[model samples]
Target: MAPKHQPLRTALIGLSSTAATSWASRAHLPNLLTEQGRSKFTITALQNSSVEAAQAAIKHYNLPPDTKAYGTPEDLANDPDIDVVICNTRVDKHFETVLPSIRAGKDVFIEWPIAQDLAHADELVEAARKSGSRVGIGLQRRWLPPVLKLKELIQGGSLGKVLTADVSFYNGEEDPTVLPEKLFYFTEKRYGGNPIVILGGHSLDYIFSVLGNLVPESISSQMQIRRPEVKLVDPATGKTIKTVTRDTPDILHFTARLQPSQYVVPGASFHYVFRSGQPFPGTPTANFTITLESGQIQLTAGSPPGLEFAGPGQEAKIKVWRRGSKEAEDVEWKWENVNDEIGPIAAAMQVPLYAFADGKEKGDGWVDIEDAREIARLIDGFYKKWEQDGGL
Candidate 1:
């Protein structure tokens, strides 16, 4: 009800002061403060666990003086002036945090892992469908410059038909051996933000989304926890706080045949290995090798290796090796004009939010609740396959 075509009045959920819990503030605030963000939406309100928390966040973010604050999802969702609600709560809290907003017919954007599990994600999908609310999932890695460039190259036949892909990603930064006190929840599968979901899920989502929307035909997977316990550390002092039994898989290796599609060659085999701890010595954090009939393309980075965001300096570059070429060529890729403070991650995130705000763009890269459900299915499939093989 804020006049048609005018900037949407938006409410932010889970924008806290702590860096560990406030991913929304870290990745979103920059883009939301940009010229494009300002033109498309306004931060009209905030909701945290308590009214004081919400008010503190609003003050900390330096949002407008009149920005409203609410302590609960229901209160925030019921605000008639709010046109959009963006939730950046923990993975396990996703369902409850955004359900009321979606049901209230408020456009909602949720961080990935859309919900704790596929069942919850399915319900949210159905709810969004019934409510006819635009729900954006934070599966924004596909919008990264390198990803789009790969898509362009593939569709344009720069790499010929992709016959197979081998993705070996080692999440070195957030290793399985240790967790900061703040991130200890990640060691448990119950939290739903384990390596399989964070590293494997997001990476696979981007990889397949760029590769002609390929779906897994038949997947065989193995999961193992190399570490029995993970040491919890005081993030500030790097001192060990305590240890908890590791309930999450540290090594996940899966091989699958992708269903034939317009882009991928028939019988395309996709092999993925997502390791929880440090990368093998002298190796990149993540290595994605796409084998095409004519040449090969590999994207290696020391960041998440998932290519969600860039690593330090030239570590995030992609190299293209044609069959006849002496060596691979470094492909040039860059993001559009973004605020300097936003960095590559937020800049990548801006695409989906902009698409949502404009309400014009559509397709595979535009991740909605339905697409989130699909990704959740993909995530669930891996676990099912792992269970079928029996736990390690």
Candidate 2:
């Protein structure tokens, strides 16, 4: 590891005490405060919907008294002290929230599904390129220990001649009965909060990172809105708020055949299915199965109703069964062993952050904005296929 020099000054947008339990607070903030992370980065500014909210978050997190609080993203972007801008806002607001920072030529890290749609994503990419600013997306699953190990095992020829891969993700969020008032925005596909982009996209990124990027030869998809009318519940009172009609598809299934590529025999393929709103009762939230000529590898991660970030008490498990071995071998991974200061999810997230910082310092250590745009295009393909097939 390079010796720490000046810490990267960072500003977090859409982070506040009001949403204290958000992914940003749980994963990003905690990781940044760790001893190891603090050595590399410093939280110099915070932006929320209002100055009062930002100030409250500063006090709640007990940040340095000198940390600046801004009501608008423009103010934070204009602050020369900030070296990187981290945006954790909703997908719909991503383009606007990150635009000012890009225009100011500042490196930015935006959470996954970079924008509401491909058009918005293209605009951001163009702006970043023109300004020569580095952009990082929150596709941190590739950095997870199990994922890294899987990639290493495949690349090292442990899973010789990969044949096929299957991934299934089931979360009960799409259920109309469990909808929350605050999350009603997710019912609209235009907001880019559907399961296909959130869960399926992450799973696809994980698969591609391990098997190497494959060109899609063909694609078939099906989408349906099982629960059109959803009842919203108030978290505080545990009472029903109101019912709203939802048009977004709650269930999505897609399969694609890849051209003969690396990491596998001539015709390796991929298939994924994501279902939301349906109750899983007592089943794992996510599972991955990869088959190769020599053996098979399986992974189980997160719990029921799983969000992208692995929740507290949830750990990932991986098992490998080779043709010659009598019994499957369990793979163990501890993030503490890699970096004691940060949690597993945070450690994964730190990969992109470190890469972004390194690119700023050393000139080339981050995922390209073009790669992020490609993922966005892949997502666009899914929606297009659904429409062409006459969505259920």
Score every model by TM-score.
0.94, 0.89
Off by over 4 Å in 2: 1-5, 172-176, 277-283, 302-314, 324-326, 337-341, 360-366
What's the true lDDT of residue 190 in model 2?
83
Residue 117 alpha-carbon offset, candidate 1, angstroms: 0.7
lDDT of 1 by residue, 1-392 (tens): 12237488989889987547656866788878887778888999999889999889888889888999899888987889999898998889888889998998888888888888898888888888898887888888887888888888888876678899998888776556778898887887778887778767788888887665545557777888788788999988999999898767788887887767767888898888988777877678888888999999888887775464555553467889999999989988877744467777677788888777777444534688786677789778777766777756
The global C-alpha lDDT for each of the candidates, from Candidate 1 onward, is 0.80, 0.75
Give the lDDT of residue 196 in candidate 2.
Answer: 69
Q: Which segments of model 1 are wrong by more than 4 Å?
A: 1-4, 213-217, 306-308
Clashing residue pairs found in predicted model 1: none
lDDT of 2 by residue, 127-215 (tens): 99899877888887776677778877777786687899887877645444567688877777889876667766777776777776656
Angstrom error of the Cα, residue 310, model 1: value is 2.8
TM-score of 1: 0.94
